[model samples]
Target: MSDNSQSAAALVQRYYDAFNAGDVPGMLACLSEDVAHDVNQGGRRTGKALFGEFCAHMERCYREQLTDIVVMPSADGRRAAAEFTVNGTYLSDDDGLPPATGQTYCLPAGTFFDIADGKITRVTTHYNLQDWIAQVTGTGA
Candidate 1:
């Protein structure tokens, strides 16, 4: 891979590492000052403050463990797709839902990241909501 591609991959890796470690500051350091992050399970967040809020929310709701992180470099070498599973235990309220039963939940998710100048400028994440609801609520249809 080219240098740019390698750099992008590294950034993606750093993001995941920070997430798994629950190091919000480290995660933000890997992002641009004006980042645009879209969490399908949560909501859209722009800039550092909003991103920090999102991170805090996640840290509170789940203890995230990243698994199977596959980073596919984009043709332009400025972006990549990261697919992984987050195995976590619900520890706090989620989306107005009550706290989970303290059972472990595994969620497969993907994030498309845009990197520029060695920092992540954008990130769009995809995940299943119904499964999360069922896991948190301990009931299903």
Candidate 2:
């Protein structure tokens, strides 16, 4: 990997590290001031302020820790992606979602990124919402 790729990987690693630590400020520091986020199965959210709100909402509704994180940065270092397993519990109800009963779940998730000037400018995330719902509701095979 080129030095740039290595640095990008390190940045992403730091972000996840902060996330695991529940260091919201530290995670926000890794994003651009005008960062764009594609919330999984939800609408797009932009700007760090909004991102912080989203993070807060997540912290209120779910307890998650990511494992098996693998980040792959493009050769040019302008883009990257990560895949991991989200081990979590439904701590509270999120709007339009099943009521939380502290349900435990493990889901594979992925996120794509646009990096510039050593900051994440855009993040697009994906996961199986139906699977999560099924696990939370005891309605799936």
Q: List pairs with backbone clashes in candidate 1.
A: none
| Winning model by lDDT | 2
Please write out the lDDT profile of model 2 over residues 1-141, one tens digit for every residue.
998898889989999999999999999999999999999878899999999999999999999999999999998889999999999999999999999999999999999999999999998999999999999999983
Each model's total of backbone clashes: 0, 0
Give me the displacement of residue 60 in model 2, in angstroms.
0.4
The true-versus-predicted C-alpha distance at residue 90 of model 1, in Å, is 0.6
lDDT of each: 0.85, 0.95
Candidate 1, residues 15-107, lDDT tens digits: the string is 889888888999999999999998796667889899998888877777879999999877667889999997888887675676666777788
What is the lDDT for 51 in model 2? 96
Stretches of candidate 2 above 4 Å error?
none
